[model samples]
Target: MTQPIRVLIVDDEPLARARLKELLSEESDMAVIGECRDGNEAIDAIGRQRPDLVLLDVQMPEPDGFGVLRAVSREYQPAVIFVTAHRDFAVQAFEANALDYLLKPFDQERFRLSLSRVRERRRTGATELDAELVERLESLSSRLTPASERYATRLVAKVGWRMRFLRVEDIDYLEAEGNYVCVHQGKQSFLTRETMNAVEEKLDPRDFVRIHRSLIVRLDRVEEVEPLAPGEMVLTLRDGTKLTSGRSYRARLQRALDLPS
Candidate 1:
């Protein structure tokens, strides 16, 4: 007979762990081998138990989910299903056939779907950690932060010799430059050290849109849109700052303007 999939549930909250446990109790092909409340315990449990699957919570006090992965990545590689309350900016990673992520407040249907993915992975006999999974884990490290559904109202940026808090509504657009993002405010620009994905996720999608690979614009600040060609265009902001939109994001720009595709 096929052995049941050994599972280890890890979460800081008792109810969160219990909720997963309760769900797992009903599944016939799964077995709960252990549980951990923090990253430290999780690391120890993972090493000692060597679970087939880990439903890991991303946020913890000292050692986070990323930390747990770093500690045991070399010697142990288990199929992981991350539990995150924060919205995913690592959509690319998830779409890359990496392990998986289970967002907070996941329903029974979603839970089963994640499990099915695991089953499919095991069925295919491709359980070893690969480059795609490594990329996914690295992506998570950059975007992982405390959970908040509220959009960012302001941003802290570094000026010549001081730091400044700039209001989000006042900013006209954002430009990506390697590791830093330039926040344009009327005539002044402030630079902040952050990834584009990290900054974009904090902004309200209704107010901002990624018009180009390296640019994000405030919707209301846009004054004009001119089509340069099929799947290409130019945008004029209220301040007369014209920026071109990328071909890949033309559809999104159109949707922001309520234009038919």
Candidate 2:
């Protein structure tokens, strides 16, 4: 008989933690060794229990899932499966070399698939996470923390064959194209792998605001907001480039401008 896969669950939400526990309970090969309500608790639990696998929430009150992982990596390391609601951070999760990511509201089939990978990694003795991967994961995790109170001052993007860093303030606007985001700055546009939602969250709200689901404009660059139709508005930039603002975001645009809604 094979040994049961000892698992630890870490999440801030009681309901989310309960749901995962309930699902894992159905698996005879998996056993819940411990549960943590926050990242700090998770670190202590990981140290004490030394579970084989950890189902961790990416967002938490403090020390977050990544912080907990970093703490574990330093000492009691375990295979990790990130549970997140945001799809935009998939690349960052992969860069961390996480066994798998289970998106929020995930179905049982997907959950089972992630567990399969974890089991395979364990059986093959193929898990070999390096220092470089950990550093990159930590950097990306810090950049994605919404409440960190630090705006992205610079962005790394590819230009032709070379990569360059662009100052955030120099960006005029951002447009979501398919899975990529086109960052406009001084008549030049750069394509980035970052989602518009992720980039928008990193920007200071006072300087950048989302005017449409696919568009974010720099407030300082806006010349005027002109009515394009009955409910739509067109934002004219100081450089005379026009970007359309969706009707649903009119109130948000007004609020950003400190104008009456």
Candidate 3:
């Protein structure tokens, strides 16, 4: 008789934790050891319970999911499956060699797939955290901003045969290209593989504003805001680029610019 895999669910939202619990309950070879609502509790639970696996959420208040991982003593480290709603962290999750990266609203099939990986690792007694994975997590954690607290200050992208790191402040504006975003800085534009909505999450709301469904601009770069048709406006950038604001986004633009709506 094999020992059932002990699991811990760490998420701030009760509904999210409950949903994970409900999914895990159906797994015959998995046992729910505990649930934590914040990073502090998660650290304590990981130290005390030593669960075989942890389904962790990336975004929480202060001392977020990454903070929990950082505080845990390496001796008690367990396999991790990062369950996040943001796709921006997927690359880091894979780089950290997480057991799996389960995006939010994932189906039962995806849940089962992650579970199966855990089972296989347990059966082979290969659940210990590797040095490379530990290094990657620490490195990436230092770069990730806790959800709703801060935003990314830089972006990493692959271009042709080389990689590029662009400073967020250097970017003048953003344009949505289907599922990709084109980050324009000066005369160069780099394509990043993320939706406009996802790209928006990585930018500081105070520094950036969305004027259109397909456009986001640095607030400080705006030269003028001109009224167009009813519920419409046009933004002129310092570089003489003109972009129209979406009717639905007009109110936000007005409020941001302190202009009459």
Per-prediction TM-score to the true structure, in the order listed: 0.52, 0.52, 0.51
Tens-digit lDDT track for model 3 on 216-252? 9999999998888877888999999888899999988
- In model 3, residue pairs whose N, Cα or C atoms come closer than 3 Å (at least 3 residues apart or on different chains), thus clashing, are none
lDDT of each: 0.80, 0.79, 0.79
Better of 1 and 2 by lDDT: 1
RMSD of candidate 3 to the true fold? 14.6
Which residue pairs collide, candidate 2?
Answer: none
RMSD of 2: 14.1
Q: Residues 1-261, candidate 2, lDDT per residue (tens digit)?
A: 999999999988899999999999889999999889986678768877889899999877555676566555444567888888877656654523336678898999988888888787788775554556556655766676654345567665667656577788899999999978899998799887667776775688989999999999999999987776666788889999988899998888889988665
| Model 2 residue 13 distance off true place after TM-score fit, in angstroms | 0.6
C-alpha displacement of 209 in model 2, angstroms?
31
In model 1, which regions exceed 4 Å deviation?
89-93, 96-98, 133-261
Task: TM-score for candidate 3, please give it.
Answer: 0.51
Better of 1 and 3 by lDDT: 1
